[model samples]
Target chain A: MTMTNDAQAVLPPVPGLEDDDPPQLTPAQKKRATSRHLAFQGGTAGKLLGYFGMLAAVLLFFVPLYFIVVTSLKTHGDIYSNPISWLPNPFAPENYSYVINEVRFDKYLRNSVIITGILTVVEVSLGVMTAYGLSFLRFPGRNLLFLLVIASLMVPNQITVISNYALVASWGWRNTFQGIIVPLAAVAFGTFLMRNHFLSLPKEIMEAAELDGTGFFRTLFRVVLPMSWPTLVAFTLITVVNEWNQYLWPFLMSDTDAVAPLPIGLTQLQDNEGLTNWGPVMAGTVLTTVPMLIVFLILQKQMIKGLTAGAVKG
Target chain B: MATVEYQQASRIYDPSRPPAVNRVSLTVADGEFLVLVGPSGSGKSTAMRMLAGLEPIDEGTVLIDDVDVSELRARDRDVAMVFQSYALYPNMTARQNMAFALQNAKMPKAEITQQVERAAAMLELEVLLDKKPSQMSGGQRQRVAMGRSIVRNPKVFCMDEPLSNLDAKLRVSTRAQIGSLQRELGVTTVYVTHDQTEAMTMGDRVAVLREGVLQQVDEPTHLYEHPGNTFVAGFIGSPAMTLIDGATVSSDGRALLGPDHGLDMDLPREYAEKTPGQVIVGVRPENWEIVGHGAAPEDGGASMPLTVRLVEKLGGEAFLHCRAQETEGMTASVRGSQLVLRLDHGFKGIEPDTTIHVRPKPRTSVFFHPENEINLEYL
Candidate 1:
């Protein structure tokens, strides 16, 4: 009945667990460790050099980000002021405002959001469902269907551009978000990735779900899909990035600012004036790259795992 | 609870070829732990899979609680399966993996939590609950797998060599734990394993399968003592039931155990009453006795001469590898200190290459037709 702070600190000693006392170090071990430490002292200089080299390599990776951020914050004048500054000297936050308010950046943003979101949603949803069916469900022609996807991987996207454009145009989807998003859906890449992941899953788990009275959809929803978090994250990244940077398909179909996403919209900054406003163009580029960077950062752990799964032994 | 009735059920793994499991008529009662055991490539595993709805039945029906699940989907079958690989979700923590099925059942979150906690406690998996399959050790992961099965409360539990992946010591302990847990759970369980030790120690009844055919099904003791066939006789025991070729012996049931050596044994009525010709004789190693009252230490068993070869000591008991002078085979078995004969070293008591007389105790000897390999008779 007494709830005192000290008593609260006195936690219940767990049952079936023995307290683990740290191992005692003998004096000889201590001396050996000291000698090892002294040996490492000379190597410390080399280790510091290696650390700086790693630092340089890491900075090498961030150089693109630094360039984008600096360019995004510079004015057209600052961008061409004799030498383009490595960092924003006189920060022109106005470039963001200009892109945000003046340049139909809102339309570009909306278009990018609609196109990328629909593409991601459609591709991921269909990819996972189709892959689960192919990987786990046994039906005739399943292998043939999987092989078809693999075959599609060999066919260049550039080759499909003309046919896809014609099909969308025939359906009168030109200048619409559907024209941009629909074609990007049902991606072979996502299906391939997710299929491999599901196939790698231990069949016993699936059998257990089957015994638990889980139907096909229920098993997929509650078991297979949830366990494929790593694949989902990795495929999501691939899908988002592919859709975000998609230039050819969008540029081929859309003719106006209202329909075009950023990769196409950013081209408008490079007017036919024979000279370029590198500031807003780079600003648009920065805007285009930010969402994916944020997504990748959030899912780095899953990305690494999924990536390794592709090569690791079963 | 489930009473599994496999009436003429068979599994043809490759319909392009012969069936992996021939027509197997077997029934496992509710709460019975029946182990289907045999060497690799035996149809025992295929039979379990058929019961689980994982392997398609080529013929007849598998009735779980008298419901024919021949055409039913695996999910519709009320059986949980445990694989050798454990197969717990590698991505989810043990708790999540265990809860997956209950979650699908749409159990209230609180109920799911309580049931998961209960199963975890029962399996001693509380600490490992937050750990993924990859994070947990083999024994811990196996417990998590059992926890997943426990949460379901399914009608039948089908295990395919679930203890094989564990280290030897862990396997023994886990096998005992699982055996006891199955008793506590009181669910019908069809366990498939190649290890006869697991079958003998764990099963209420053990069924022996070989080459897609059911050999015999009986209490473990009965299987060992009264095997229905030569395969079962040999498969059910360690140092397997020693068999002597009957085709090379005499007509009055006297076995010529070696060159210039012969011993008279009465023909078992079971074999004599039937086809009275050549028959292989079966005897467990323990049934053998040395018959040299005034002979050397190298003497084997009564009437059978053996040359001492290698001896393996296991604390209290030692297995003497004694080669037969009459055949190409060697008798490997446990011998007490009084009976053991070694040539040299710390065990310098017995000599090597000396002829030792031996004989199998009467009535313990089983006779089989060398052609069919089936028991000469069953009593």
Candidate 2:
């Protein structure tokens, strides 16, 4: 059983090694290869175009934010000058003091915090429970109930404003925190978002939990909720921003400074100062915008991940 | 360990369509391992779920140790399940996952820790205790899943295709491990799989299901040797038994096979009497004996010419796939007109498109009535 060179002598030459020249490719094949190479490298021109598009998007969104910050620091005279100043000259840092101390912005900030905090907590909790029930629980008309939940999303909020205002007014709930918080606490969008995310989770995990002797609530807290942090955080962030910026319903519901949120307090400030005073008003706008901006910046990565949870499989 | 029984248990997901699991009655002895095996849509998993209390038994009762548990919730049934996907808690460490059921049962923390450590040692998962499911390989995660159910020490273990997700090489080793572990535990277990080889090698008794109906339940050797009908005959064995249809019974009481009537054999009197005009002859791959090339019959056995189409050499054995020359112009059987012959490992010199002669060994062929597809010998 000796190995021999005779076998190699009879073996045919490899197909491309018969000649030194590389095998010729058809035009279509050459084109495909070049395109594939370009795609892998992301082509220099395409990379430049992509960067330029991103720059345009940044400028488009940030310009208004830049205008607000600059206007907030400008003096009353500088704001209305003939040559529009893009930068604040002797930055009127006193404008923030005027809005905070003179206009009593602390009360409105307290009201906003209370309303937004309670609303976000209540809405997110209810959303999670409702989504869990709709996705996991067995019932007679579960699909029909889910349909009703989704159908509510199509209804415009403005159409229900009059009825909500009438109902709150009749109960003598005007100018109260409950009046502003109660109606908005029933979350439809959050329920829909959370339900889709829950449905995307493997159904076998819940079944496994049941076989492990876990009740629905324990399973929800221990097994389900731990895996759903991204969506829950996203839902909470959205709810906080929406409730904090809520204007029309609160304006109709609250008549006094006692329960009026920041949005309503901004209008009160405007009414007191008249149209000529722009510095303090811009300062107040910056104050209201900054809190949400900070929140968004801190949690933006998780918020994006949560929003696109079920759109693609990992 | 406890015995489990299904008294006509059925699950109907939709009223208009056929039941997912039709009325299926089976009984498992204490400490026995029974495998429910079928194709993808054959309701094997549904039947196992019904016993686990994960699925509602729409029509009949399922009992554990003589206690009816049809209305019991999954958690109350005291049965553990290993899902096809492993279904380990992605966020929990392996130790935590195995300890979760004990925690829910309100077992003392010290006892839970001891139980988890013991199960981990048995599964060889000591180093993997702190690793999450995502951090472990597929095989490690599977072992953790097995440990989770073993830690429970429930009355019954329901495993739904637990090895289906592993790589081919790993599946074979894990298959042996699971079999040996089940033997050591000696719990009444019901395992579901679509792989016939897995079912045959693992179960003490394998139950074959088709379209939500139990086809046959028997020991592996018994099921392989004596399948009740054509479906079992064609499905149980690898390469499968080639069934030639349009076989007829001559007026002389001889079983005539092939379109040209090239082969004839004496059938049992009871079988020959029951055959209506046509019969189906089933012959296992190993049962075929290669006679000679273009030679006449020597022992008066039926023989047919075959054209070798492919030769598969599997080191220890070879399977020759050939087309029946006699049945060339006839209507093909359910498995087509190809006949497979299993040969010894040293068999050689056969190539594609070469001609050879083969015949079913004496008394090795099973006869079936063409219309009903029932084994005539059984009838």
Candidate 3:
């Protein structure tokens, strides 16, 4: 077949916006045109507002923290003269030393360490086992049992303090580590968190492990635990913080400096100094707060995920 | 390694509702690939899980090697299952996932490595051995799941819709790969799927189930050619067999086609004698042929006088979607008088609104009683 130009038809002129080169415009006109497109297209103004908003939130949290740091460094004279000063007039690192000696801070630190350490380990382990059994195993009254666990969350710690104290006194556990740590570990929050995390796990993977000839404990430790490090870390961080800062239960239980955790020990400074010795009190507060702050900072990501894992479905 | 059997196995998930898997008895021979196929909620997966000892068999026994395994735990039963989700351990690498079962069994490290390596090589997953399941594609993850089961070397392999997770193209290719892989391993396998094509293509023998009841267990050719009932006949084929109900046989052996008396056809004496009242006549799409147009009956042969409502012309064949002019004799066979006729692609220039006379071949037609819908073939 021969090609022919006769087949080609003349093209009709098209209307509307056919110009390849943009029209020349004044700077003001260009500004108007560009601003119209930018206004609805994630305008720079909105992004600037977001950055400023975040900065405001950071400063809001940082101001009180800076005051605590300054107050902890201040001497008695400087603290009273201008209470809200940006910097301490005279630095007295010796206040921490005084508080440590007067409050028997060494014993208290040891007590806090032991109490928090045992509390975290027992709570996390029990939480994991309980969560695993509740999530994976099917038995009669499983959901009812889980509901009972969730129901425990509704019971405030204050209401049970007297009864728990009476029970501990009856067991001759007063001024003992068991009284303090055991009562704290009995809370259901950790189990609830860990159970929700386990519930979100794919059911088939657990079945696969069973068919692979893995026993219950082996599956829990090897398969479930390894995959759940985030939620584990999250629960551990929260538990450590809660155990370290525990006050009323330990205060009511521990009568001696040897058994009291940091929160109760910090109170000794208040009881002795009668509010005049704010320096040592703040210093003790800082000491108790710093270690948990470090833990929270390190595991902040997993902690948030663990805490919120209940609210979000997998 | 062993033959597996379900002797009247049943599972009731909730007491109020019907049993998920009703009493079902089936035997899968050693090294045989048996596929349990049904629609969703049809208890196919429940039956497979019962055999694997994952689901508790409520009222019957599941046996392996002629030993009742009903009371055994899933781990103690020594069976492995590839789940539909391809549930590879997310934290473990592909090699570790495949070797996990062996490790849990306390196999020697060298033996575990050897088995994993062999299975991985069979799956061609050498380069992906170190990759986590999250890092791999769906098909690759599926292979890793298969490799995990293969490393265990269990007595039976229970696969539940393993290919359902893959895309269409990948599903076809992976389906063939799993079929060949099962043949090579020769382990007694019980597979579950809702798709008829997968059941047909993959199984040595396919067991069709409906509403937790076993319909038939037969080879693919037998199931296709000789379904046991209306449900199996309608479900076994792609386009499905068109069943016209309420047809009556005259004393002269001429079977009336429709309730509207639209067409009449001759039936063999054996079938006509067995089916005296209202009967169901099943005709596959390909079996129907266009004989003549705009004419009444000459000799009494079953024919459908229909108007071509639509024409689907593929490159190699055409399906004439016709609608019966009258409503009376039309059964629920091909969706309310909309019958489809598959013809040669060479038949061109056919358009809608044209009339055609279609009849099923004599030997190919099957009859079922209208009330019970059971096959009349035994008579």
Task: Please give each candidate's TM-score.
Answer: 0.81, 0.90, 0.87
Candidate 3 off by > 4 Å: A1-56, A100-102, A137-145, A170-172, A301-314, B14-17, B258-266, B292-303, B327-335
Q: Order the candidate numbers by DockQ, best to worst.
A: 2, 3, 1
User: In candidate 2, residue B251 scores what lDDT?
Assistant: 71
User: Across residues B1-379, which tens digit of lDDT does each residue of candidate 3 receive?
Assistant: 9999889889999889888888899999999999999999999999999888888999889999999999999999889899998877777789989988898889999999999999999999999999877678888988989999999999999999998888999999998999999999999999999999999999999999999999999999988988889999999987778877677776666567544454554456677667656678788889887777667446655466788889887767778888876645544344356777788743476678987777776578777877788888754
Clashing pairs in 2: none
Worst 10 residues of 2 chain A by lDDT: A305-314
Per model, state how many residue pairs clash.
9, 0, 4
Q: Identify the leading candidate in terms of TM-score.
A: 2
Docking category of candidate 1: acceptable
A49-166, model 1: which lDDT tens digit per residue?
9789999999999998788788888877777777657877687777777666767887887888888888888899999988888898779999999999989998998898888888
Q: Write the per-residue lDDT of candidate 2 for residues A1-314, one digit (tens) a residue.
A: 22224547587777886667777999988878878856545668989998899999999999988988888899989999878889898789898999999877999999999999999989999999999999888799999998999999999999999998888889999889999999989888988999998998887888899999998799999988877878888888889899999999888888777989999888877777445577788899999988998888878877665445423211
Q: Candidate 3 chain A — worst ten consecutive residues by lDDT sum?
A: A305-314
Candidate order by TM-score, decreasing, is 2, 3, 1
- Please give me the DockQ of candidate 3 compared with the native complex: 0.37
User: What TM-score number comes out for model 2?
Assistant: 0.90
